[model samples]
Target chain A: MPVSAVEVLDARFDAEPDHWPELTARAGLRADWSWPVLAAQAWAARVPQLVTVLHGSEGPTGVVASGFVGPTTRRHRFVGPRRAGGLGGLDVRAPGTSAVPGWWFDTDDGHGGVHRLLAEFLPGIRRELGAGVCAALLRQVPEEALPLLEKRGRLVRKTEPLAHLRAVGDRDAWLATLPRKRRQHLRRLFDTIDDDPTTTVRTGGAVDPTRAAELLRVNLETHRDVPIIPLPQFTGQLTALLARPDVFTIAYTDPRDDTLLALGVLLDHPELPLARHWSALPEDEGGRPGLYFHFYGELMRWLHDTGRPRVSLGKKMVDLKRSMGAEFTDQYAAALPLVGLALLGLP
Target chain B: MKTGIGRDSLRGMVKTGVDALWRTAYRRVVRSAFATVPFYRERWALGGRTEPRLGSGSAEGAVSTEDLVRAAVDLAPLAGGPTGFDPVRGLGGLLPLARPTAGDGLLVALEHPGARPVWDLPRGWRGCLVDAEVDDPALPEVGAALGAGRPVVAVGPDKALDGFTDRVPGGDRVHRVPRRTLDRLDSGPYGVLHDPVLGYLGVLRDCGLWHLDWTRVYARRTRAGLAFTLLRQRSPRLVDALVGGGVPGRVEWCPRHATPVVRTVAG
Candidate 1:
């Protein structure tokens, strides 16, 4: 039988039952979207944070984090990574602008429990905050939360078309699903690595500090257009992530001189693998042409062999992700004033 | 007694509703865009606007698509319109634009006569037109919408219309309107700036934590919708996330016209 009542508790995330890893598993969270991962990212960014657990009559159903940015008097809610629409302190409280945080929920309630939690829990927070928040915003939430939000009358949505890969069978099976042109392109990339003994890819091992440092080095090189958290903060976050058994680094090396040509990071989750970050050396640094292509092919192969279902490259790189058989959606954020939404009695 | 209206049935109903919801709204917008803005005008509207295209790091109308499918999901209409264009107000109009879009549908602001300050659309939504006519005298009416009360979407020109003050003491604003012809067909300067039929929706307060705003979209315009959704079905990450979430619904994209279809999945 299902429990009729659920409770929301404002507590440290490390509380009883809904503990890290354990609750994450129970909630069926993905690495990038989960509270633990997001909190770590937010912490690295030095954002203010708080946690709330949605406990059903039986146990905890969902756990979400509220990251505060801007002045406390006019703070906004932030949910996921800063780049993925998570709020930073600066963008908060610009006149007429509200914020939506990145958030995740447990899989236990079929996400219905998440809605109940939002409906009951969010209002409770409004009163607690005192000055009162204008509205709650969520970005890049999947179908799970979308439908639940749709049930509300005033829903604002923007699809985020993300790049992902699904493994039906081993490498060959995966390639077969791609467009013939794309398949041919990828085949050549994979064949180039296979045929050239000089270049090799490595996976399935803990990343030592040295390798982690190299990953950061390459990251700075390629992600100029995108934002990177402060190095010390990122390094700290990377060390914690590397400590996890499920997270691993993928490194491509030039065999002749053993130079680190390109590096990518993958966070293994029960649902699918998450491509957290990656960077490659410039040509002079031994970054060979087609290294990105080769690494992705190799990564797909590994996912197939390991029975991992899919991989998320996060946001951006639309055309490239599309050619690799990826679909995209938009992410939207809305602000509904607490006093009005409740008083007006609208969804 | 057990009813036929089980969770699966409810899921089916919602999926059907969602399918109609996105496509219906999309078609209307696309139809409106194609009919209202002439090809020559799109160039003018496309120019002068400078917000890095809305999605995936591309500028709006920056990378043009030749594929028929990509044309259907074109977001240029939404992104480059006016800086002040708010989807919040437009969101309500979507249901009434097409048949079968569920919810308490919205009433077009024009439906009401008189130089009214705002139109009270369905579901407590307010619509405001920011144009030359707004006077200091109408500040209260404009302020009422901008004031901390209900969700309002105000549309206007590059500047806060000649007379209206854009400042709202307590509103979650998302933009600055720039000049552009969003609706050439309508003799008026209907560029997105002249409209706030879309405004900011507030943050969602929580039990212990507060969450800010969130919105969802199918595809940014000029991207191939059918191809993308088709690829989604084959995607393991998507399949797992969708199936794992246990929402009994599927988005069936029509490959030919590249349309949206909401399907109810069996539990």
Candidate 2:
């Protein structure tokens, strides 16, 4: 018998150590997907019933990424990843697909084997879901997977805009680019507080874990009036980041009164040149004077002064962020074909 | 020696006067009810037909304090009940005279002789009541004149009622009240009694108002000290955050005399 077979199993993180690595290899080998990072992210999300495993014959050939059923209301119906400008990507419409599945493989040799492996395994999982499965939404899908998914269901293309900011040279150089009026406003703001004998902006090392937790609590409370999906696992991830030295926390305070008006945590990814997991005090609290804005500004200045290349001012606040001279980046998702569909459509 | 004793006596008298003034300031409330108000008089007359002793149990055989007190207690059920505000014909007995439309979307107009017509309507999907106090008595009469149908009233402001009336049978009708009479009822010393009763009735008219959409309300109150009855509703995470003793996102404290203030996590 020919040794051509692909197996799909729903496995947990503890069940398979090499599962993530295998998936990444296959994604890179056949479709340029990043499955490894995605698996880590999914694990971090604590999404129960994570449908993932290694697939191949005899040995691992590719990784399969899947998640539980997630519902979207009429309000959040528009939420999904999409292609924008020239950036080709997939929008995870099914409400639970990962942005970066981090599937990587050595494609230097050939694509036939890996493509066959993915085509065979994708449908097997869909069949397993059977009538229960409606449609699969994916984002940042590579071009190769498009032909396969098109055979399975309708592909609605859309464009999603994402904004980003790049930290230029020292703080002054970054500030120099701002319109003179804005720069003057910033200067007056800094000077107004600087002159106040009681007010002080303190720059320091990693945020005290206790204080970081407090900032998170405040951030959540400030938004209590607004409706949003709760992220229960965020605290654990935040705590983990706090434990690392690379993570920096800054506080704006009235030193005389020993009152902390605002605080922020910036996760410095030196290799990636972006600040990850950045959140601050909500703006209604006098923004800069309120501590969150002040701390964010101080943190940006520190990064610039320390020769850090760039910072990722993670999502939202588009207009204000762009005014501060931050550039933008695009995120993507993709869909894969089910085995039966590919086999039926094979020419 | 006698003069010193007299001075001490005078001081004691001043102290007693001051105490009386303080007590009156804190505990005294001026309460008045419309005595000549046509609605009360007419309602009382109707009530007297069944109960001959209506409004006669107290001094001067007028609607006495005791009658007012009894009416207050009996009026509780009239708030948003199945049988509209049962027309109380006698002083203390309530009679189910007319059956108002009983639907979630139906609006009711409380017509008072010589007072602005009060329309108690449903407030969107939230189940609360939004009250529009139109000075025009014609408005309530228009609504009352409305047969069993949905009618849209074009509400405009003018000293003289200037809206054109087009009646569509089986359409919602706009109830109306006479202007001069509604003005008298809405004003005068008796308004004190009328306002609270109207507010209470309005509260009852909308069932959701009593509960106050507890989900969002309780979520808002989780951080505050407002008391609420916790029924077996879907447990929102906000309640969990409040009772579970986790770190609060923000702590808001409103002093009795000062403005409300919020302290964020960074503060």
Candidate 3:
């Protein structure tokens, strides 16, 4: 019997079952799936959070975090309201971070329990939320999961590409691989901050939550597409996140006034340390220019010192991130509509 | 399922023309639901409905929240969406967009947990969570923020704000705001504003009158008033849902805006 009459239970990250870690690892999920990171993200957003666990007769079959990406961020033209268009339909993406599907399943999912989970249960979620139009928006879904989702009637579209910088040998060895022009360009940007006595970049620095939140808000404003939460909520979330042992901060400060100018938050995974969040003041507003480019130098330096294999740089600035020797991966957003109108009454 | 388009073609179409691909896929899915899904099939057959149209509201009849809630599970079209993050759901993510000048500082007080006012703040301006339903541990921190000397904009219902106002200092700084005012601010000057049920569906402003979002709903003139047919919801399929208490309006054209306009008696 392949998971007939399965039940899906919603559990808070902290209250999840004891075997959750073993289950996650068995399903091949990364460090971002851990309780601390997910809980921190939920608390920071101040949004309601839950993780759906699929239960078959044997035991747990699958797990994924419920991350709501409203019309504000999903941005696909068809999914929004007609007038403001940005305000219609609810889209729930898995994990809500990184360029990977946060969903993981037990190998025993052989009986197409995923199809049942997708076809029947997901809509129950939409109704629970009191949403009329609900869709499952999976980000960075791998190739293997396509048929399972598509047969369930999801409209998958190509999203912006994601980048990863493999931290091999030392900084010198990595720089040697890049073209001469590209190497010189990077060196100049890195040296501008390195040589200047006024500027200082330190990895694993004690970051001021308030300052980091402000810098992040400013940086997010530059990219209007990203959702920027309120200041106090962001600060509170950052406070909890920075307290985690597996998380570290790279701070860029103006030594003269002791003002924190830029911040980068990284999640420590043995193989791939993720650069989760980065923010800086505007260049024209007494902020150092090329800080974004310069931070990668600091990241590489930390990677060499710590002996990590690579860094997941995340999406955007594809050309620039690629030029710095970061490999790119194609990403997609799959939309699976969960409700139909006949159920709402107008035939 | 016989439009000659395969699953692989749909996947391949993702890289090239996405809009066309989605429309095609939606047509196929909707067609399949009307034919295969038990709910859509029986309802449409009784109503003598034929092929369903997209963008326009459904071909079914209107239903009530009670009726829809009763048949919730029966609305699934035999497929899709999620779980995990569905345990708790909260409304209001639109923050206050009020940006205080460099000299004057603004302190936003969220008196209600559900109240989300969009705000674009400068360096000194900050937001404080001041929920009045329970004894929030952050009251002292809010007191500390108020001590910094900034004009406060308290957002919440009157009762909630009363509790907050009674407890917190700086009586003169706190300005209680109503839900309507927040709605107006959120919609902007030109954008229409209407409160949706559970922050999902409700009336929208059009030509200074209230109506359902046409793209998401289809309204038909009935003896009772206007019955709404949900255009694009997936789960429990709602055909014609009678919200009740609405006065029907005449469809008109506005030269100024150059879009179809309706003047309703309920504005």
Candidate 4:
């Protein structure tokens, strides 16, 4: 048993440790786990944000980032908004990201760590968030972690598939590792992108935060039900993240008029460089079709050249991501009601 | 009543205490605003400001009344705890009618009959929709509430507040509120000055100087006027907004007051 003290601190508290970067690197967690990124998310968040730090006798064991999800919070098209003050749940997930659990524990007993995280320390999180927070919504629990979580809470039946692309060696070696169909399709996309005369694919360019946010908003508006982050907050978060040396952008622009058509924001880590956010103009509105694939190809090339192992290609577009040689992880959500009474989204 | 301690020593102590409180509050508000409120997050991002500190010349623009009116709900911090201001109806939700606690006294919320009936009088309180715009029948009732021996706090537009006080018998107890939308941010921290939209900005101390509410609001002097960043309000989030026209006051270190003093400059 990892005998430890789980201390829940306000995610924005000044004295909280900047342990995110180190922990993220060790666990290959997504880019949204960083202190600056979480801080940016917390600053614009309407509800209270908390970070549960599980400290062992040796040092810190794990950290879980969360916030209270208000009743009116419509998280994408699938999740319906609850009645006012009805389901003010503690969301144990990163705000505004592809489905992924916002926790990581470095222990041999993974199940034990998770048990302690949910069963022992959860009530404290609820109290900090407020009494109205009557349930905890844990998103994107991996298949391996499902058994333990399923025993304690209600698991949403649908499974979200998380995508990942591995860069085993140089460009040629990486191509060989992929399936024949995906490899050939990727080559065709790359060739088209390379031969195009009207467009220019520029990697490692400065991203104008406002312009990028506008492009993202356009992309999000394509889906009728999804609510986009207000442009200013999105721009602000991009500004902070993009300023760092490790965070870079790949842009596909119209060289003739210098208009930005597509943009891919990537976070660089020694082990995995993540393609965090991607936005492009639709085909009818002056955007080229092969931009996303080309962006992925560029990411793969960078990983090979930099000797990085893999890239975190975020959620959705499951079939498309799979056709491009990405592996999938079955992700499920677990909702544990804080109060004894059953709540919406719970069993 | 003067002690042996010098004026400078007293001032130093006040400054130290105020600075410490200001720093803690500033960090909390700024960080929270960025995380949950899109207005501040976007504005600060466009301004190229990061890791903000007091007096850091980050060149933040002022928020206008028009902006607040348009994006009132969006202005509310998404994850800001459970209770406080309600996003749908600004100040009206502060005190729900269902729950009424005693010992705090009664609050008379005066509003123009035409305005959205956002004010729901809490238990032990009363709401009278007085047509302050013109001569209305509700004035007598307001006057009656003020005269009733119980402690009463009257809040409304300047004209309405003024009209009630001028006509009412116990007008001295009635508090005059500002006409501006941003200024009427919140109703009561009772005697202290506060903007529900901008958090508590300052308190008018007995020493005849405005003591900045460093814990709840962060203010900066701009060429236009004093720009305020609400340090603590979660709902109806407003940050880096310029107090319209300009606060006609000069901020100075007052040894006698033992804190930073805002001396009102009479135009």
Q: Where is model 4 chain B poorest over a 10-residue stretch in terms of lDDT?
A: B91-100
Question: How big an interface RMSD has model 3?
Answer: 19.6
DockQ of 3: 0.01
**How far in Å is the alpha carbon of B127 misplaced in model 2?**
29
lDDT of 3 by residue, B1-267 (tens): 588876666545543353344345445545654543434443442233444443333412444545444344334443332201110111122223221223444444444465443333344546655668777776666666568765565555457667876777764556554333112323312222222321222222333433333344444554544444445555444554444333354433333332223344533
- In candidate 3 the C-alpha lDDT for residue B248 amounts to 52
lDDT of 1 by residue, B1-267 (tens): 996687666666665675677555444433333222222112222232212122232232323222211222122221123212132332232322222223332122221223344322446444444334433343456455444443333344334432233344442432222222212112121222111222211111111111111122333222212111101111010100111112233344433222343233220
Candidate 4: which stretches are off by over 4 Å? A2-4, A13-31, A70-88, A123-133, A168-186, A224-233, A340-347, B1-37, B41-267
Worst 10 residues of 3 chain B by lDDT: B82-91
Tell me the tens digit of each residue's lDDT in model 1 across A20-121: 567767655544434444434443333344454555665665555554443322211122212211222122211100111233444545643445445655
- Which is the winner by TM-score between candidate 1 and candidate 3? 3
TM-score of chain A considered alone, across all candidate predictions: 0.73, 0.58, 0.76, 0.80
lDDT, candidate 4, at A93? 70
Give the best candidate by DockQ.
4
Query: What is candidate 4's lDDT per residue for B1-267, written digit by digit as tens?
Result: 887987687678778888777657766776666555665655553344444433434333556544554445346544433223322132333332112234444454455455444443445555555555566676676666666664555555566677766766787876443323333323323323434344334554444445564544676665545666666556666666665544534556555666554444441
Worst 10 residues of 1 chain B by lDDT: B232-241
Q: Candidate 2 or 4, higher TM-score?
A: 4
lDDT of 4 by residue, A95-145 (tens): 456545577677645553456556545754554445676767776766665
Query: What is the alpha-carbon lDDT of model 1 when measured against the actual structure?
Result: 0.42
Per-prediction DockQ comes to 0.01, 0.01, 0.01, 0.08
User: Whose lDDT is greatest here?
Assistant: 4
